[model samples]
Target: MGAVTGDQTVDQTVVVAVDGGGSKTDAVAVRLDGSVVSRARAGGSSPQIEGLTRSVEVVDALVREVAGVAPLAGVDLFLSGLDFPAEEEAYRQAIADLPWAPGALLDNDLFAVLRAGTSAEAAVAVICGTGINAVGLGHGGTRVRFPAVGAISGDWGGGGGLGSEALWHAARHVDGRGPATALTEGICRVLDVPSVPELIADLHFGRRSQGDLRLLAPEVFRASDAGDAVAGALVDRQADEVAALVTACVRRLDLAGEPFPVVLGGSVLQAGHRRLEDRIAARVHDVAPHAELHHLRVPPVVGAVLRALERAGADGGALARAEAELVGTAHAALVGGVAR
Candidate 1:
């Protein structure tokens, strides 16, 4: 479907774009000319975590809340937990059945990072958030990706993984099985436990959920910054994993010699950790010499809006306007509570 333009009424074409991740989902409705009509934020909507039905329900609720009285021309979704083709097709059919729009475009959330980071025709995006994943677009529409289903999929070095590692080392140290480090103190402080054994008891006894371990990731970084040997090693390993993902994608897509944008995003990468960022850059440069690294500055949801606009044959001007407006709206929502 093409975007309605100039002479046509603005209300004739409205698109709702959503970026659904492991922690939260963001949705926005926009006119053909790039004006935002409405937006909403909701909790995590990953199919793998919440199940297909519940995930779709969360997204559908956000879409309706954003679309409101507007007649949607199309809907676009970039979501997490769609690791295989069957999952993608299932979600496509489910979303297609929704009456909110006539058609929908869907893909993994990594593409949102790619689109948000650059307009390059060929690019790679590495997301190191709660989990780690990557996607690459190459010449002739060639695409590369990872299963990204955690350790079983040979993936590692996300916040969840790092946090677990921190706890492991801390536990080992407390038990005299490993070298002492600041992580034990850091983890105990962050979790508000007096000792490692107490923290262990709490988790084992169900007083603390396993998911709470992710909260220790930042403490790992803090200890690393404070010159803790174990934390520094963990940070280095994370950098290696992130770089490995980029190297694999670039090689698989055969974009190693050609210049392409390598987009870095997600909470871990975007946390402004100089040590991690520098290590990643140096490692990526070793293999993909021509690859340019870009840290995503705006919300990945903006990329969903750009993709929808592109599908509708929007011009460069319209795309730029949409991006600018969406960035402002996201900032407003963050600070002023206007779009939540």
Candidate 2:
């Protein structure tokens, strides 16, 4: 949608880039010059799990939030995390059916972020927050993914899995099946509960449990830093898993070229845990010796914005400006804004 000034026309032909993650949705709408126009967020409504109606509603809410601040009635959307073709179609149809329709283009979020960072067709990118997913892109727009199987079953990347592992260690220690460490104490302190039994109870009752469990990840990291064997091993194991993911993507896809560009993102890596990230990077190299791992710090939304701009053909001076504006927004306008 293009921006409206109480007129039929919008402020300018713009590109609206959106990044929807499991935790939150962040969007940035910009004009040709890339100056900051409007930014907003809404609840996560990925149709993968969230029904079509709910998914569109959350996106609409965020779109409207931005539209209220600035118009997006005429912009093209470059949305991320829309991988499964079925899921993508549901979202595409919903957007097309909308009266506010601003030509929306959808693809896996990793593509948007990858393009935002560089022009590599053979690159691997990762997201390590609430959940973790990896993508391998080859020449002529080919991609491979290490699927996110979801919690209780998801692979050992992302905050949720790591947090769950932290809790698992604590429980096992009590059951006499694992070695003792400061993690049990750390978990108890972080949860603000007298004991594990009470913590489990808190999670079972009220509006607790599932979401708050990931809150223990940071505490686990802290204990590991202080030389807690249990915590350190857990962290190291997860890092290895992340490495394996990228390596598998490459081997499975048969990326015959020299090392592809590998990028990493997610709460687990970006959470001010440089030591953990460094360890993971090291492990990644060991697993996929040929790949060059890029320690990127760019926000995913900037990637989304870049894709949107390209889609809208609002390039040249306008593209440069819009990209610059959107990058600024990625840095300051939104919270936890990763590559779209």
The prediction achieving the highest lDDT against the true structure is: 1
lDDT tens digits, residue span 17-36, model 2 = 77776667788777756665
Candidate 2, residue 165: CA error in Å?
1.4
Cα distance off (Å), candidate 2, residue 125: 0.2
Compared with the true structure, what per-residue lDDT tens digits does model 1 show for residues 12-64? 46888899998899999988777788889999999987899999999999999
Backbone N/Cα/C clashes per model = 0, 20
Candidate of highest TM-score? 1
lDDT of each: 0.85, 0.67
